[model samples]
Target: MPKLSNDKNSVCSLAQKQCCIRSLNSIRCDSGVTSAKAGRSCEGDDGNSCMDDSYQVCCSCCALGLWMRRQGQGCDADLHLGPSCGHVFLTCCEEVEARSQLPLRGQENLKPTVLPRRGNGLCSQRCSTAGGRVLCSCFPGFFLMKDGHTCEGEAQYYVDECAMRKDRCGKDFLCENTPGSFKCIPKQKCLSGFTQDAHGNCVDINECSSLAQPCSSSFACVNTVGSFNCQQKVLVCNRGYHTSPDGASCADVDECQMGSHACGVGQICHNLPGSYRCDCQTGYQFDALRKVCTDVNECWSYPGRLCAQTCENTVGSYLCTCTAGFILASDQKNCEDINECDQKPCSQECVNMHGSYQCYCRQGYYLHEDGLTCEDIDECSQSIGKLCAFQCVNVVGSYLCACPPHGYVMSANGHTCTDVDECKVGSHNCSSEKTCFNLQGGFRCLSFDCPHNYKKVSSTYCERINCAPNSFDCQNSPLRITYYTLSFQSNILTPAQIFRMGPSPVYAGDHVIISITSGNEENYFSTRKLNSFTGAVYIQRKVREPKDFLIEVEMKLLRRGTVTSFLARLYVFFTPSSI
Candidate 1:
């Protein structure tokens, strides 16, 4: 036998020669070591186990031959035994010594190895004891030991057999793992609208024909790959209809605003759901079943009410016409009154009303009966004494102011009478011998004092009243008489006779009386006294016939009962005019 040393200088050939001498089954481990069989003591050495020259250590007697063969030297190859023969082995001595120092099973130490290895092949986890026997075991993911000492890997780790060798299965099959071998199953997958059968083949599913399909009765289902479609049915609408918002129903179309109505001009279109109507506008009406608009006789509709003057009917409308003096107004329906007075038609004042005008006058004027003309009012005749202070003279529309007979002027307010001073305006008819005196409405005259015997006879002069009866100027010269001969043709157209008789220097007390005598009996001849002291003769006649006449005139003077007589002769002749 050879002994193994821990020296680094040992020769390798020395272990090969000595390791062949011992039998592999003869080695055993002692009790009291963790890798040894419990209750077994070694027969070779105390605490000593087998260690060959190849550095193979054996803590059990059964693995000595198998452990030596694995070193690949010239060792025993005929000792054929299974790992189940219960043995444990190690290659290094240091690992065996370290595991032997652990406390034995059921010892009171806290870090004790409670169950030791059964036959020296160390288990991956622990060993348990039961019924006075020891069995080796691994963790939960591993298996029980076959060698009564050690455990191998788990069996759930499936091997990839196809990856290693592709011919493990046929082309139409899939490879799956079993405990120690693999199986070939056929490959298949169903399409979208199909399902798988028990025979491992894809089959078509009729979604449209099946009762359990997702499509409703109102819809149609379409089949696709692995799916189906639920489509709503289309609804057909009438001529003037369109689809509803839901896209499944129909609704009517309005044609009024859409310009589909057949209404003509002057007509209005009214729309219904499926039809339209034509109607006439205001101020117009449809004729006897006519389609277009026609004129409406408003004048005839309401008799005598359309206009104040004339009402005329036109095409589709009516007109209101006024007479000559009036005009139309703004509102076409109602006839408004025109203001004819806007042009100042009246002479004085104008008033306007419906379709007419009126003329009025001021205070002193009146409206004529013609209703348009104005005339002046005769205020003088109407208001007699009230018009002026004294008298009223009528003018066209007014009255004139007059004063009394004196030299008077009218006042500014023509109704008041006023007085004027004749003395100041030189209007008095007074002589040189008299003095004028102013009085109300007139003037007065006063003569100067005459001589003692002459009494004032007039305002201008005075004559002497004392005279001698027969003196040269006494008795007014006895009423001196004068004679003259006169001739007149029958054609003389004069109606007066001319003769003069007077005595100069006559006294005022003398009296003369003249008369016609003898040839004056026809009364065509006559005489007149020229003054109180003188006499004159005059004759006048219309000599219608051719005749000759002799006339006599007498003059007499009477003073103090003495009479003086005087005679004068007058002759007349007629000459006939040839017819």
Candidate 2:
């Protein structure tokens, strides 16, 4: 009842004129705000502000707000409706300024414009009647029809697999899925003192099976995912056993008996049962405590027992072994006897005894007379293999193992049988001093000749010739006979005494002892280095050329005794200056 105005379309013709006036005055034209304020704004009323009562104000250009409206376009300018009605197209300058604002509503008769947003696609999800069909809705108080087009008491996820029984659901309600359909599921449990038969009908579980849950302290029972559980209590010994009294109390058990303890080597025993197990004694261990039977090294008591050779712990026990030369003992506590002899006894023989063995030689053989050795003996007469002779010398425990005849003898190195050169292969060699002439069993190299620059003083030695002119004439000199006073001696004595003659170079001379201080004693006789004898003196050696002796004397060599002990070892060396 305030006021009324009309002729809205006619304003389009006036728009250019109104815009020109705005430019001339540098003022703004506001069809929206100015219309709302003046209620009918008259742009050229000079200073008078005017308003039209029949026009609608608009705010945006994006929602088709700039388009003019037709009377039958579901809207009437008489009432002014719809989001986009009659707003002028904003120019570039105005759009730049209005860009910060939200899309504007231009008509009041438009349904309450809900600016849901592009991403949500609100229009697509909203249900509406389409193609002669209406969408379903869960209304406040209506039961539903067979299709989703009607509301029901309650809705449920329907299973399409049982579509055969589409409209009606039976007793049990199972969920199902379908495009615009659902079904009811049934109940499988009862609240009352009710019971269900087979076929998955509601029933009661037998709690009497203890299924509801029942057990003592040493036992356990757990409810299952859908049921219950029951377990037996673990049994234990009363005072000293793994078994209970009435066979019923759970008590501490002594694991030391019943052979339950699988102790290792050097370990004592223990036992357990029922809810029982084994354990090693003091210095041993249960491998995992899981099975007390399995023992391992605690090694606290017997230090070296574990690694005597290398003791390795095993499942039920540890083992004690010996080092290469040692063995496990009977008590199993210490290392004991091992037979090194069984493996190698020096060489030829092996004998094993408690802790050791002794080596011995066999017949036709002799130990080297040294505890460390064994030597072959010669038993030629007893056994041809011993020596190559009819006579066999048995010495000590065995005969000589030698090759003696046929000009051959055992070599100095013992084992080798070497050929005798008659000069080099025999026990005694009469070499250049004697004669190298081959003989029966061996050979003889005997030389009785006087050496150069020396005259034969005795059969075993020579002397330098020096005398007053015409003292005595040798066989090769002038024929003159003369006597000589001789002095000869020997510092050493041999097992066999021999004869010695000296001080005379030829047979034409005779010898005599001037004096003696009991010449019977060996040391007294050789005092002046004078010759003494214990064996009969043979004539001066005269065989061959330049014999060792041509002396004129007589003496004897005792066959029974010889001197051995001596203070100084003297070497009586004589070189022949002439012979």
Candidate 3:
């Protein structure tokens, strides 16, 4: 490559100008340059000098820098200078007036002169001119080399406009880098049911309104997110034939199969073409108004023909029942008597009757309050009179009359009691000195003796002996003493006169005072004066049990001014009331 001086005057000199013209025929220009006047000298006082207005001067390679200086610009080394003066010039100058007006051709034969830089020619990737200077650039992924003309780097080595803050996207836009370039994308992206507007906003899309006839004529269309749906239409049909689900046609409905008929529990349902019928079961009747089955009461319908004794109604049947004491016969309608005696309901004896039984007791037994068991009859407690003269002993079924162990005997009647003569029968235990006396139910021995001043007058009486004139004992002693015995039952009434005492011969002027002196400690016996001479001894209190008493009765007689006393020894006995 030929070199040019930095001095513009030397680059535009005549010698350098001639030398550029010789080289111009073989050089090529990549860009166009302006023409100048013909026959003009290449020399000028100012540094901005050029050749004449001709094609030779415009196509010359040396006059490239002169034209630039004349155009008030500077030369860059990276620019290409062709051989003809019509190409971009950098160093020499020349002129050809008419040739400058014609279009230049034959650039393949023209030789190109590039400044000393890295690259095959002006640039490896891109080349341009700006501000009167040649610029070399690379694609987005590459960078300019140190030579200022070549591009270096691979596809992976790129400039991130986003990270480097070199993108022209606004706040609403996102910067996306590509292999050799970058793009501005909207940040707000539209979803399935929406679309993006000019302002980059997401707006809803009315698919229902926008789409043409999306649903069939029988269905209504409904819109959804990113989709649509079809719904069935409503329609009415005639009776028994209902409309289909799609509302396109009508079909028959089976009332019996669908359980929609008005048949009762015991009725059966049958389906027809468009209607239904209900039938009653056996022994039942159908009611037209209620459409239900009713049962037939056979007992009420047949009355006496159903049963002999009684009739009862049952569901779909009848029943026959007998009275309390009767049972139904094998014929199921007639009644038969029940034999109550077979059950042995009575403890003693049971007699069967037509419909019941009677209870009877044995000879000595009677019926108890319960009417079933027999109990012993207490004759001893029930008899109003004395059934036995002595003690009546009650046995299981009868009573027995008992006599005293020694002094009484049971009579031949077996219920009467008799007194035994112990003296004559030799059953008494009396000594030789005592006399045996018999009573109703017992016996007692009696003996009387005189005192020293008295003499016995009889077996029961004693008298005092005569006294001398000075005998005081004889004067005061009893003139007579008598012994007596009495017997009675313990049921004897009180205040009974049991004994009486008086002088054997009645005297006109005799007054006696009588008293019981001993053996009356329980106050059971008392003495009373009657007519001043006769006095009686009476039993005052009744004895409820058998007892014996020996009482002494004393009497003082005041007659003719001489006092005389008498004594009576009385024996009283109380026998048992029943014996």
Name the better of 1 and 2 by lDDT: 1
- lDDT of each prediction vs. the true structure? 0.49, 0.34, 0.62
- Give the top-scoring candidate (TM-score): 3
Candidate 1 residues lying further than 4 Å off, grouped into runs, are 1-226, 230-232, 242-261, 283-293, 304-310, 320-343, 350-355, 360-579
Q: Which candidate has the highest lDDT of all?
A: 3
- Model 1 agreement with the true structure over 1-579: per-residue lDDT tens digits: 111111121111132223312323333222222233222222223122222211122222223322343344323221211121122222221133333443464132212122222345433233334454544444222345567654433312333456557336877788875433457877666666777687877888777776575776556788766677889878888877877777656777777788887888888888766677888888888775756688688878974566655678877667877554456656644445466777887887664532455565533455677766778656558753446555667899987867766545567866654445576678888887656644334455543455443444443234455566555554443233332334433444344434544322243477877777688667765676667865655546667765666665666766658676554444455533211
How many angstroms is residue 6 displaced in model 1 relative to the true structure, after the best TM-score fit?
A: 70
Supply candidate 3's per-residue lDDT for 172. Answer: 84
Candidate 2 versus the native: TM-score? 0.17
Q: Kindly give the number of clashing pairs for every candidate.
A: 5, 64, 28
lDDT of 3 by residue, 185-243 (tens): 87876788887788877777777788888777667888876667888677677788887
TM accuracy, model 3: 0.33
lDDT of 2 by residue, 1-579 (tens): 111112223222232335323332232334433332222322122221211111111212112221222112321322222211222322211233332242333232322111111111111111233454433222111233454322222111222535555546665566564433454556556655345575756654454353433554445565543355556555644455444444445545545554444454445544444334333564345555444433444443454435433454545455665544467767664565576666665444333332344344433344353433556656545554534222345678856545545655565745444445554445564544554533323443444455443476444345444545654433222122122211111211122112322221111223323222222322322322243321122222212221122232222122224211101111111111110
C-alpha TM-score for every candidate? 0.26, 0.17, 0.33
What is the descending lDDT order? 3, 1, 2
Instruction: Look at candidate 2 and tell me the lDDT of residue 496.
Output: 17
